[model samples]
Target: MADVVNSRSRSSSPSSLGATEFKFPEGLVAHRENLPAGRVTATTLDGTLTKAPLQLIEDLSNGCGGQLWPAGIRLAKYFISRYRNGDELTGKRVIELGSGGGVTGLAIGLELDQIGGDIDEGGCEFWMTDMQAMMELMEKNVSFNGLQERIRCGLLDWADPLPEFVARRPVDIVLAADCVYFEPAFPLLEKTLCDIAGPDTEVLFCFKKRRRADMRFIKSIRKRFVMTEIKDEIYARESIYL
Candidate 1:
């Protein structure tokens, strides 16, 4: 999946943004006779933890949200790395926006379980949300991984009002990955962020830059939230070792 995305990022441009053209390669069946369940394994946390084999049903027949994208993979791993032993996330209320496959939210639960934390008792209260289009597959993944107790799924169009369950309490964190695609959604997403997150809510947004237009989304959000780039450690030697 990462290879396919890297190839697209290298080949595509704003004028020829084939974001919706992404699909499984011809004859490369995701499901075979041996694995008749039509599911695939995505090793999160660098293979330290494996999510239950997710049912691979990429309904690109409708839209691109059904497939797992690379940015979501990166964000999921980042959450796993940041929340080890559940120190910072023990009881915080978290909400993952554009949670296509619930990877990041599931990774948080898996990480809690990895470090001897009880997801049913000590895990962070988390909600994974996306537009109505992606609800079925997203909900299936949550149940497939046995995360019903730790995470909830809902329909969350950024332009619409916040769901009643989420608005009941102050959100502590907002997680989004690869959500900046269409230009029209920029303001809607920005508004949703401001509405859901309070002054203290931590927003972890991750996206691979596919076009200069992607900058527009950043510009709109900057007015409401102070932004900082998290540089890779290997490339930040001067800043780290200085």
Candidate 2:
């Protein structure tokens, strides 16, 4: 089986922010690594005026998924470039797994809202989930962007059972970025994916290769699901490989 690998071209330093709160550096500076607690403003998708200024508190003092990673940015771009308006997302149940800072899901919510509609009339609903520790920042991001009604934030630890609210219905799309590190969590992640994903469900993962151990994580999931890479012409030349 082909190992799942997705990459995006990296950019410059993009002007570092102080250890406290900071907004995302403006312009084409898309990638920022290990920023301490800060607020970041980024486009919801590509070639669109919609912007989501997310308030993120990254406590490096915390363990994995604390800071925003580059793959999240790339995945946001992919959503913007691909799912314009709510056409693709309309009537679908969307969820972002391991949603650090809630950027990807928030972006989608913004786009869906902009496209405009009530849930009964083809509008989509979103769920942003992570460990309990990340709830504050996730909720802050959801509220920061005025998406409370459209997006719901929840505690979703991979090792635990899926919340009743989440498993009550089928999920159409699962968005995950920079979530496949830490060797010990591999089985937990795989089991969670299997539990949530149906045969027809689509899971879009955006991540740069980090270590050889990542392959082990991918190998574990391949037994249950087929993984594929999507190449976007808009970001093809700009993508940086891990």
Of the candidates shown, which would achieve the greatest TM-score relative to the real structure? Answer: 2
**Cα distance off (Å), candidate 2, residue 119:** 4.4
**lDDT score for residue 140 of model 1:** 68
lDDT for model 1, please.
Answer: 0.62
Query: Residue 212 in model 1: shift from native, Å?
Result: 0.9
Expressed as tens digits, the lDDT of each residue in 1-242 for candidate 2 is: 11111122122111232323234422223344444454343332334425533334444344456555667666765776678743777777777889877656766666545333445688776778999888886776666667787788888999899998679888888888878767788789888889999988998877655588877777777778887768655444544221
TM-score (all chains, Cα) for each model: 0.73, 0.75
Off by over 4 Å in 1: 1-41, 48-57, 114-123, 233-242
Q: Which ten residues in a row have the lowest lDDT in candidate 2?
A: 1-10
Best by lDDT: 2
Off by over 4 Å in 2: 1-57, 114-119, 232-242
lDDT of 2: 0.64
Report the Cα lDDT for residue 110, model 2: 68
**Worst window of 10 by summed lDDT in candidate 1:** 5-14
